[model samples]
Target: MVYVEVFGEDRVEKIKICGDFFLYPEDRVEYLERALIGLPFTISEEDLCAKVEEVLGDCVLIGATKSDLARVIKKAMVRA
Candidate 1:
């Protein structure tokens, strides 16, 4: 379970859960990413947390920060 960047290299990038996260159908990740795009980064941590929990309540969250995602990505990248 990890959070991944839903946005691209463009500005206003955001984070989202990376795993299956109880999302049905195979395209849910792509859908989630699209849902998060264009959202401002000005959102507070508490607000973001609440939003994430609501959107990904079924997800087994790895942690509550980008650093956690980075760590997981790093490990995956290394393993690959």
Candidate 2:
């Protein structure tokens, strides 16, 4: 599961990501979170996925994919 909170109207003023997912080179998760901080709340899943992949680079994700993370972020936006 993942939790995301996004703020602001046009751009994401802040974002918080939390989840029960496995990521290789766990330290890179911070990079992922930071990468998402200023994105537009209207960002598409595919675009977000691409950004996540860019941030993850060569890291192997054990139990999640960039798509999965993007989906969760979209869901959170709906809830927000």
Candidate 3:
């Protein structure tokens, strides 16, 4: 599972991503986290998925996909 914290009103000021999933080239997750930092809180699942895919590139993920990651982000938004 992933836990995310998003801060801002009209725009995303910051984002924190934490999870127990496995991602190859582990630093890639940091890239993903950074990519999401300044995005709008209202960003759609598809857009987030695209960003994840773009950042991930050819990296291998164990037990997760871009969609799954996007879904987790969406859920975090809902809870926020």
lDDT of 3 by residue, 1-80 (tens): 76777666645566677778788899988787777777776888888888888999999987777788888877666666
lDDT of 2 by residue, 1-80 (tens): 77677776767666777778778888888887777776777788888889888998898876667788888877776566
List TM-score per model, in order: 0.41, 0.81, 0.82
* Model 1 lDDT per residue over 1-80, tens place: 55454443432355454653344443544554555565554444455455544554465533344334334433432332
Error of 3 at 51 (Å): 0.8
Worst 10 residues of 1 by lDDT: 71-80
**Model 3 superposed RMSD (Cα):** 1.6
Best by TM-score: 3
Q: For model 2, how big is the CA root-mean-square deviation?
A: 1.7
List the lowest-lDDT window of 10 residues for candidate 2: 6-15
Q: TM-score-based ranking, best first?
A: 3, 2, 1
| Total backbone collisions for each predicted model | 0, 0, 0
